[model samples]
Target: MLRAGDTLVIWRLDRLGRSLKDLIAWVGWLKERKIGLRSLHEAMDTTTPAGKLTFHVFGALAEFERARIRDRTQDGLAAVRARSRKGGRRPVLNVDKHALAVKLYNEREMPIVKICRTMELSKPTLYSYVRAANGVTDGPPAT
Candidate 1:
């Protein structure tokens, strides 16, 4: 632990944290309290003016690396978007089945449950078709 007037000396900036962002924030907090940071291997010391420049350079490098990564990722996604047959499962209920379901639902006196069984359609799918055939666009069916 470091007191207000003490310094935190380490072998490398990496020893402070795994990433440059963490190191920058920690160093900023330490700087706020007039607490110094010294990295023995890099000859950088926050107690001196020149050492602050060294960390500024490191921060700039980290920002550049971050921007480069962002640009590359965006480019990769654009390439994927350009590929043929954009992904999603094919429609489960087709035209012929939809027509048959609509007919059974509208025509005979058969129960709705029986119609679903005859068409081999789920209750929800049958309801959706009935709603569409009657031109009801929003919300649950009337009954």
Candidate 2:
């Protein structure tokens, strides 16, 4: 239950919910209870008709912004795919380097730290290459 003068605080509207239907339901519930909802960053309040209208406008704007972001992300991914470019961080170890690193670790009795230092890689990166060479489908286990 809510009452007048009670402040309902939210970090952001996005944190409240992702969809317009959810937002409307929450706002409607607050309105029914006479609760004043406020978003710290967005400076929205639902205690007045003007405030309620502003919240609706804000929700619409947020939805539009989310759609635009999703569109741009898809477009970027498509462009990269068209160009045959891989997304995400490039692997630090190529096949030859990975093979050599693994051999040195397994056959030459090289320490993991030494191998990582020689290959100018972090421990995790060196371990991943070693694991791959060992026919382990999964990369280095999560820390």
Candidate 3:
């Protein structure tokens, strides 16, 4: 819990806020609570008007940098997609394994736990396979 005179010290001003708006809101909140914010790297102390102004300027620049990085990432992804290439982790189970899991789940003869253990899949993964096969059930098909 934070008290009225508590101080928040951070390595850098940029680390304190996700965005400019968030930084402003946080500073306002701390001010209202009579708390001080100090950033070692920036040598900023929010207890003073000059420090608060400096922090806001730094926060805005940080957010601008983040926006640029996001834009660049999106552009790179778009370029990759244009080449008919896909990104992200491949599915753990291939088509045959997925089909077998779905079949076992639809059969409803084996307990869900046993099926998961036999297939080396988690409950959620097994259920997802069943779902992809359109085997909609209110709950697990078997014991």
Candidate 4:
């Protein structure tokens, strides 16, 4: 547990806060409680005036870096959208595959396992296709 007049030593300053505003708030809080902050990687100590200034400067730079990263990610996403492309995995079941799975399920010439293996589909998927073909939206049929 941390107490007043205790020093909070950390491996890095970046791990202290999420953003510049957050870091400033934390620094203010520490100051009010008479707690010092020491960052080993940045070699910063908030007990001294110079160390405090350096830490603030580093916090500002970290915030700037994060903003730039956000801008780059947005630009990349916008470019992808402009090309009429979509993200995420492709659908597992399409019209043709759905039709074949339902046909195989209805014929009952093969075991469920064999049908799944032949169609490269899971047993649940095969059953769902059969249900959909039979006009069952979900669950067991009504009484």
Best by TM-score: 3
Residue 114 alpha-carbon offset, candidate 3, angstroms: 18
Model 4, span 13-123: residue lDDT tens: 667775788778788888887999998988899999999898999888878878898789888878888999875557567899879878877888888898888888888
lDDT of 1 by residue, 5-25 (tens): 899888866556544666777
| Full-model lDDT for every candidate | 0.74, 0.76, 0.83, 0.81
What's the residue-level lDDT of 117 in candidate 3?
Answer: 93
Displacement of residue 72 (Cα, Å) in model 3 is 1.2
Q: Which stretches of candidate 4 lie above 4 Å from their native place? A: 83-143
Residue lDDT tens for model 2, 32-112: 667788888788887777878888888877777777888898899899989999766777877788788878888768788
- Those runs of model 1 whose alpha carbons end farther than 4 Å from true positions after fitting are 59-143
- Which of candidates 1 and 3 reaches a greater TM-score? 3
**Candidate number that wins on lDDT, 1 or 4:** 4
What is the full ranking by lDDT, best candidate first? 3, 4, 2, 1
| Cα RMSD, model 2 | 11.4
Clashing pairs in 4: none
Greater-lDDT candidate between 2 and 3: 3
TM-score of 3: 0.58
How does model 2 fare in lDDT?
Answer: 0.76
1 versus 2: better TM-score goes to: 2
Question: Which segments of model 2 are wrong by more than 4 Å?
Answer: 1-6, 32-34, 85-143
The order by descending TM-score is 3, 4, 2, 1
